[model samples]
Target: AQSVTQLDSHVSVSEGTPVLLRCNYSSSYSPSLFWYVQHPNKGLQLLLKYTSAATLVKGINGFEAEFKKSETSFHLTKPSAHMSDAAEYFCVVNPGTYKYIFGTGTRLKVLA
Candidate 1:
């Protein structure tokens, strides 16, 4: 079985500041990890993904995450925050099947 957890349910940051959204996963085998962002009433957009390729994966809008097998973590980070960046983020783990395990979700609030 595979599961994902988002450490924080909500994250607040000032515009132009750094952003960090933590995520952890438990999997029986090497798993495919992904980050997705969703604006209000909008569909999810793929941020980045790690598929046993690189430990560090970069995604759109200056977001990136590092896969740490030892720690069972894949925390997402951004150099700077933007107002448009405020959204709900999800960490997902694919167990190599049609089903995907998703984190509860993290809502990011960007303040000016």
Candidate 2:
């Protein structure tokens, strides 16, 4: 079937290091992909997205991702992760360019 898979359910990192949260997806259509960050007790915020126009996309808080059709992946990456980056991140896909179907979830841990 069609779905998004975040390779790691959780990622731990030091406060001032790079962060890598892997996400891979598959769809019959050219999909709409997104990364959303949710802080504790807060709603989801759009971090970045790939809408087929651009392969490399960037979003808030110095995060970016590349849409690779060959690899069937769109992984979230950030240089020098902040202490505030300790939050859950979700990989979302829209098969019809409508609303999103999100992955289960990915929890991020920031260690001082």
Candidate 3:
């Protein structure tokens, strides 16, 4: 079985500051990791993904995550934060079973 854990339930950042969202996972095999974002009342958007090709993967909107196999972690980071970046984020793990395990969620709040 595969599962994802998002360390934080909410993250608050000031506009223009760096952003970090932590995530951890447990899987039976090499897993596929993805980060998705959802704005209020909006559909989820794929931010980035790791499919066993690269340890470090970059995604849309200056977001990136590193696949740390040793730690079983894939933490998301962004160089700077923006007001528009406020949204709910999810960490997903696929263990090649065609079933995805989703993290609880982390809501990003960008403050002025």
| TM-score-better candidate, 1 vs 2 | 1
For 1-112, candidate 3 gives per-residue lDDT tens digits of 6789999999999999999999999998988999999999999999999998979999999999999999999999999999999999999999988798999999999999
Model 1 CA deviation exceeding 4 Å by range? none
The order by descending lDDT is 3, 1, 2
Model 2 scores what on Cα lDDT?
0.92
- Cα lDDT for residue 3, candidate 2: 94
Candidate 3 RMSD to the real structure: 0.6
- Report the C-alpha lDDT of model 2 over 1-112, residue by residue, as the tens digit: 5799999998999988999999999898889999999999999999998988879999999999999999999999999999999999999999885567899889999999
C-alpha TM-score for every candidate: 0.97, 0.95, 0.98
Stretches of candidate 3 off by over 4 Å are none
Q: List the residue pairs that clash in candidate 3.
A: none
Deviation of model 3 at 35, angstroms? 0.3
